[model samples]
Target: MNSVVRETPARRELPLPDGAISYLEWGAGEPGKAPLHFAHANGFNGFTYRRILSGLSDQFHVRAWDARGHGETTLTADPARHRNWYVYRDDLIAMAEDFKQATGKKIILAGHSMGGTASVMAAAARPDLVRGIALFDPVMIPTAARIVMLMSQLLRRRGNPLADGAEKRRAVFADRQTMVDRYEGRGAFRTWPRGFLEDYVEGGTKPREDGQIELSCAPAWEAANFRAQGHNITTAARNLHVPFALVRAERGSTCRPPFPMLLKRRDPAAHVMQVPGSTHFLPMEFPDVVAKEMRGFAARLEREGR
Candidate 1:
């Protein structure tokens, strides 16, 4: 017997206020299948997680959206107006509502880094529409770090190294190949698996009027995202009533010490695991592991009739 083949992800757009949200959808349009929405990290687009999402397409109706100020999303992304990550939280909530309305079913939420944090915030805000959430190394800073960041913000000081690095990132590249060459085996991308960097380069750049490819996510916007960390993720994590699973990186994790312990304390039912030898980019380094955790979490939620 010949095995059936699934279709590749379809790029689509959902109309929102002032603009549209671009997303990629995978899996057959099979009814009764739980819908899963994946959000990408800061400075990354939906297609960056294509491999992971595509793998889950067979099990769940998978969709991944490029967050505001990233990829093909047409939402307004004014750096000056970006005060905190609440904007991203609101956007994810909107997307979840849309998905719920369209499918008439509660959706599962998952994300990486910034996306993961936004997923938690959105799930907490609208648990009615979200069945559960699985996060990979969401940016839950330690208490002392948060205090220091708050102080820096109060003093109007620019002490965020991530934001500083983002501000200094090269916006324009000669071509995609140049970007691949520059990014391959370097810095944050050093641990990325094969084809992941290429996928990022393909989806993270756009053709400029000058015939050059520029970063879809502008440096200022990325820097703004990095600096806009005022959102209270602790409260969000605490507010979660549905199934929650967090896969944190062992090395250079943004979900720092005590935060994970705090999460476990707040909700002993919340699943938190640290991958051995994983970096901040856990999804890229261990896509299968992350996907397995997500699949298992969603399956448990389903079994529990969540």
Candidate 2:
């Protein structure tokens, strides 16, 4: 059984070039203290990771936000405009800048999977705004895999295959509990705790006027994110100069050893931990472990006076 205590985070929004991004805050966020800004994985929202984010609030002020198409944030009406994940990277950069300006200290950027990849990209592009980064099984495809994935995109002319799955996904349910009941112990959510799954269902969906709940992030957008995985993560990893900690799942990690090895070579100070018997959804399955490492990364940054 999971023993982590969860808390409700304050919801807020930040206006961006295209639309406003919704974020959740944990802790007081005292001024002059460096804040931890988090991004959620693809198809998931900031609220989905509340258990993990809330666990670290005692030591640090943390905030997590929904990407363009996830959670309460505005969706991208035109997927054509965001062919790559650079748009997500830019949004992260903007959020970091805004946090720096608001807190008068560089923010610690962190994320999982697609969110983690975007954090690495933002940190590399604008190192001044970020003091450090912690990635949780970031969507980092190896060079050979990347080439194959990109080449496979050419074979799908009937729109993105992943997107098709999203489009066919069930969006509404009888209620939140019903959704939770159906999702628990089923498919990808099998490893997720009941409380965490409930939180995800509560935050990821909204009640419609028709007396049903619907996903805030439309299927097409989630599919677009999967299809737009051609970003150059290798270059970003090479360019990252900030202190970074990467925790990968042992069994089904999106980030393999070579990528973490490359990151260690590029930044010797970087920390890497592979949790045995875990999957890519380590953040959800092991919130306490992930939060401990995040705090440790912060401690390391403070030790280095970064």
Candidate 3:
């Protein structure tokens, strides 16, 4: 008898007007197997949720993607590329367009951390494409990053002091084993699971003329993300034209709850779920909880989802 080895979803890179977008899809039938589209976190790629797909395969056709400038995706030379945060949301809209064309199913949009912000905006912009929202602490901050966005550019105008700081951000190990030992000794995996640091080490670096690898996205890019995170999702929530839910983790400084509060304050019908034991990275930490909540939210949207 021959043994069959199950293969992971063969991800295809899509050519967008801006650049190539990397995404994964897993399903057994058409309509992308009852779609659920996930926008991943800041540091990791879409593959981080492979286990969730394995668990939810019976229930949903799960899909996720790497955000631009993260994972194995390419970066554009145009400084004007990231001028408006809506560009990121538009990318999701384009993906949803392609998704609808291909699967003919409504995509339930979910995102973790900063990706959550993009997901929310996209859901609001195209309610017809997105069925509902499942946000994991959508990087919901009180203020929009308008002032700091200008200041960071001003500092660049004077002098790009931190222009290449990401290049300087390197970790040295006595040896491979020593490095592994160090991370394992500490609770880094407990904090961040799914062999994600490898993506940072891999996607975050490029081959230099010398034997070293250089990170393409600068430290300034990360800083600018924090600055852009100032976009008030409260305003974004008011613009939502569809059913939505924001799932917040009970622990961690990174968790933001005000997003759901803003939704509820604007409309009392929105749903907000908070899991007691998880951290900022709830889907990766509590896949079962995430899967269950997603099913309930989706079902309620049809029946009881307010």
Candidate 4:
């Protein structure tokens, strides 16, 4: 897949209440074909998944968007305020609605990390807009940890460790190439292919007047995402009525499958599988596997005709 050159996607933007949401579309599907809509991980934008989405575009029309405060999407008013993960869910719901109204068909939701979590909430809230969901290691805290997470919010802690760490991130770089060089095989980006890393640096950064580049998504906003995790997945999972497929990473994943066992129990058709030798960054490490899982999900939905 890495050897093949992919086509550049057309950029588009949508109007929101406070600002506009930006996205990329890979293919054009006919009237009856269900388009696939993808939400990206926290701190990362839709362009980061260009390789994976573009690969699947041959069979499925693909659209991936940047979350609020990420990529080219304008920063929300008062970026510091994020009570919970529901804001992202709401944003996704709006995007899904807009997409459906424009295309005249429901869409399949596919996402990783925060994107996956928000997808679940969107599907639950507006089942009419979503045909099915394919989640890749969405962040789902266990019952015990969820209680503590909510308690910390109630307690009003002094500083958010994640937010603080994000504030300390180096956002300015000499150039996009410099950023790519630094992340090519290091830390969280160790498993990413060189082309994917290049795509991330090129699409996720904007040139500054000083002849340097800075991250489009503010570090503070990324930190805020880490700090906010109060979405009630238990309810969302139970409420989801459409075909659902989840792929979790085997090692150090934030999403634990059993947390939403009720979905499996309620609908025996729902599928959940943990990918061995994968971590929180499974999509980046194994794009083909992620694509395969999503394809299988679409096939299941087609066979079930739900």
- TM per candidate comes to 0.94, 0.93, 0.76, 0.93
Backbone clashes (count) for model 3: 4
Q: Encode model 1's per-residue lDDT on 1-306: one tens digit a residue.
A: 111234578998888887989999886478867899999999999988877877777788888999999999999999998878988889898899988887888989999999999998998899898998888999988656777887897697767889889999999998999999999999889988658898899889999888889999999999999888678887887787877888999888888877787777756777789899999998888888887898799878878778
| lDDT (Cα atoms) of all candidates against the true structure | 0.86, 0.83, 0.64, 0.83
For candidate 4, the 10 contiguous residues with the lowest summed lDDT are 1-10
**TM-score leaderboard ranking:** 1, 2, 4, 3
User: Best candidate per lDDT, number?
Assistant: 1
Per-residue C-alpha lDDT of model 4 across residues 115-144, encoded as one tens digit per residue: 999998999999999999998988877667
Candidate 3 lDDT over 159-254, as tens digits, reads 223323332444444443343445542442465453444433443454566554544444445434543433456667779877777778888624
Query: Candidate 3, TM-score vs. the true structure?
Result: 0.76
TM-score of candidate 4 to 2 decimals: 0.93
Best by TM-score: 1
Question: Whole-model lDDT for model 3 versus the true structure?
Answer: 0.64
Deviation from native of the Cα of residue 23 in model 4, angstroms: 0.3
